[model samples]
Target: MARRFVTLDVFTTRRHAGNPLAVVLQAEGLDTEAMQAIAREFNLSETVFVLPPERPEHRAALRIFTPGTELPFAGHPTVGTAVWLALHDEAEGGGTEMLVLEEKVGAVACAVEVTGSHAGHAAFTLPRLPEAVGTAPAAGLLAPALGLDAGEIGFGAHRPGIFSAGVPFLCIPLASRAAVAHARPDMGRWQDALGASAAFVYSHETAEAGHHYHARMFAPTLGIAEDPATGSAVAAFAGAIIAHEPPGEGDHRFVIEQGYEMGRPSQIVLEMSVRGGALVSARIGGSAVVVSEGVLL
Candidate 1:
């Protein structure tokens, strides 16, 4: 049987930008190996297999995969899949629709505002709060891994550390966006310097004036050399934010610009609510546009 799949560019409004995701609909019968094979075939950062919900109230159960392995949770796949379901699976006639998707990590709630088009804006609150897992390698070891000087490794109160919401990321703060754009993984040194850690490098400088931060991610271990827009990393990044740039007890929003160096300019909105000097809640929001859809033979 031919399976239906849709590809979307997540975290951006334009086509051929942001992170590309392939979503296979009605994927109940596909086993894990089959799904992994299909995801490798797609060769995107991540692929989503949407099946009937385990629970009646949920919209669907999603299985996310990279070329190399399965993932408990991922950001772009969840957002793009939710938007695709709201647009094609449901007929809400243009309003905000809520969907609860069962992922390996847990049930994730998504809000899709259907604004009369294939393109849409979707956001999901973090089901799990970010926690500091550990500290990163010293700047000396990290600089060579990222092809940067030790002095460029951090700025303000930010330093290299590990954080996780659903997935763990080695959050490294660079002094300026210039360092971010120039930074690339020296793969030979990468494995030895940061084992089992996907590097999520960021800077306080913005490419576009309105955006508040800039970022790029590399995870060869997960078969992603570089990712244009990474929502999970951003979600985990809340920990890095709270650790370094402490915000007052209120809602704070930051628009992060990514993929510009890749010419796929992506914007992701991260909103965090702080209460009693602790992060109470957080949400990741972004826009995605349909690029193409096809049937798998």
Candidate 2:
């Protein structure tokens, strides 16, 4: 069967920058195994298989996959797919559009801005808020896994922990921006220190002014060497952020800088709504551009 597919650079307006995603549009008849195989062939951070929505009213049902496995939900794919749909499948010319994407986690509500240029912005409130899934290994063990010294492992109130909105990641806070840039996965110790869990390393010092954070993500177990940008990690990091940063009751917006070192420099906008000193809701927003489109045989 022939299916249509488009590749997009997510979290950035540039064509070659940001975390890359491949979205298969005519994926109605592909099975789970076939989808996974296709994802491996594309070899991007994540690939989206768009299926018919169970509720015909919704936009589409998405099955996100890394080369190694399927994800209940993923950030880049959702953002990229939404923009693609708004510009192509659900075009309304030039206005904000509201749609729903059904993922294994649940329904995700998205708002996309239709624009004059190819770059369009999309934001989706997380279907599931982050929850503490488990404890993190000590700084000593974590440091060796990422080729960092124990001293560079943590700063301020931030230590290492595991959090998941839908996909789980080990949130590791480093001492400085320098420390974040110095990270290199020690493949020998990585698997033992963290089994099948991706690592999200971040620092307070950022590459861009006014940016709240700078981050890097590593997920070899999921067949990703390093991700240019990671929305799910940022979403999960919100749980850690609220615990450590502890913002007062209100809506807070933060710009996260990522992928600078990889040359794909990407930015992600994280919005958190708080009430009574507790987080109530959160959303991830970014822009994506279609780089190319072709038919998959």
Candidate 3:
């Protein structure tokens, strides 16, 4: 059987930028091993296999996979898949719609905005709230892991820490964009400091004027040395921002610029509502462009 697939550049309005995701539609028969092999073959940051929703109310069930392993839930894959499905439905007379998807973590609600037939924006509430998993290694240990000096390891009250929304990452705050841009993960040190978790590095300085911060992500353990855009990282980042840069009791929005160092500059919009000095809710939103489609025999 030949399965249909579509590729999209997620978290950016334009093509050839942002994170590239391959979504396999009509993926009814593929098993876990087959999906993993297909994900490895795509070699993008992530690949999504769309299957029939276990529940009739949901739009679809998503199986997200990195080159190395399957994920309970992921941001870009959800956003990209939602947008692609909306557009696909639009061609068949469906207009802008809200979709509920079944993921390993839970049901995810996504709002998709379709302009015409091709370009669209998608946003989704985090399936799980981010929580502090644990403390990270000291600056002395983390600096070498990311090829940075100890002095550049932190900014403000933000130090290295572990956080998870659905997936976990070792979040490191750099003193400047220079440190973030120059980062190169040392395999041995990375293994010691983060083990299986990926690294999400960020700094207050940004390349664009309207952006609040500059960021980068590295997941060599997952076969992704660097990612152009990472929605799941930003989802967990809401916790970090709330912890270190606590906003007054209200809603706050931030635009993060990432992937400039890799020449695939991307933007991610994060919205969080805070009340009683704690984060109440969070959402990740971005645009995606469909680039290609084909059938896999």
Candidate 4:
């Protein structure tokens, strides 16, 4: 039998914007090699394979795969898959209900509330605590690799660090929006500096959009020069910011805008809290749109 897949755009209010993901439903019999091959064929940032839930408490088993390898968890895939499943009636309680999914990382929970029959319409929330792996990249090597001058890097907020809710990314804060917009990595220097980090470089700009931040990410090692919008990176960024920001401030929440240079405008809401030297729960949420609904076969 031929396999089937559905493609959807995530983190945007319209189709063709946001990150694209392919969902392979009911992929119980497919092996790992086959899944990877299928993922490679799809060639999206990530693809999701839905399997039978091992335990009764879980909704469905979700496996996330990048073009290169399988990831323990990912933000867009989780959000897009939940919405897709609900639209197809595979998830519980129909379109208005919250969907709980099982993945390698842990049980993830999200809700898809439909606004209309329009292809690009749905609100998604990843209601789970983000866990940090506590691994960070060195600052010395990172500065030169991104073509960032010593003066362009801020002292407190610009410190190079690593953070992850699921996948670890090296978070770098630049001095200004101009610095972020003009940043182009020195491939040789980046490869040399972050070889051991296995992390991507992410930068941001302050925005007036309710939350005061804009963001961008680069992962040349993964064969992606830039990601249109990265939810995982946003979550990781939130973790690092909460830890680095000064005390005596109330909780901070921001909307991170990205993908302008790529022409696919994207938005991500990052929320976090830090207390007693430990960063508390970090959550990243975004809007998704179903650009197309067709079978891979």
| Cα lDDT, all candidates | 0.91, 0.92, 0.91, 0.69
lDDT per residue (tens digit) for residues 1-297 in model 1: 898999999998888889999999878789999999999999999999999988998989999999999989989999998888888855555434788999989999998865546788899999999999977899999999999999999999999999999899999999999999999899899988998689999998988898889999989889998989999999989999999998999999999888899888899999999999999999999988888989998
In order of appearance, the predictions have TM-scores of: 0.97, 0.97, 0.98, 0.86
Q: Clashing residue pairs, candidate 4?
A: none
Residue 184's C-alpha lDDT in candidate 4? 78
lDDT of 2 by residue, 1-297 (tens): 889999999999888899899999879888999999999999999999999999988989999999999999889999999998888843555434889999999999999975544668899999999888899999889999999999999889998989999999999999999999999999999988998889999999999899999999999999999999999999999999987887888999999999999999999999999999888999999999989989998
TM-score, predicted candidate 2 vs. hidden true structure: 0.97
**Candidate 2 runs further than 4 Å off:** 90-96
> Considering every candidate listed, which one attains the maximal TM-score?
3
Select the stronger candidate by TM-score from 1 and 4.
1
Best of the candidates, lDDT: 2
True-vs-predicted CA distance for residue 128, candidate 3, Å: 0.9
lDDT tens digits, residue span 1-297, model 4: 566778888788788888888889778788999888889888888889998888886668988887778888787887777767766663345554666788887777665666445332333333444445655445566678878775665544557677767677877777777777777788889777776344433344454446456667887676557887787777666666665663333455677887766788778776565566555555566777667655655
Off by over 4 Å in 3: none
lDDT per residue for candidate 3 within 240-282, as digits (tens), equals 8877888898888899998889888899999998889988889
Q: Distance (Å) between predicted and true CA of 261, model 3? A: 0.9
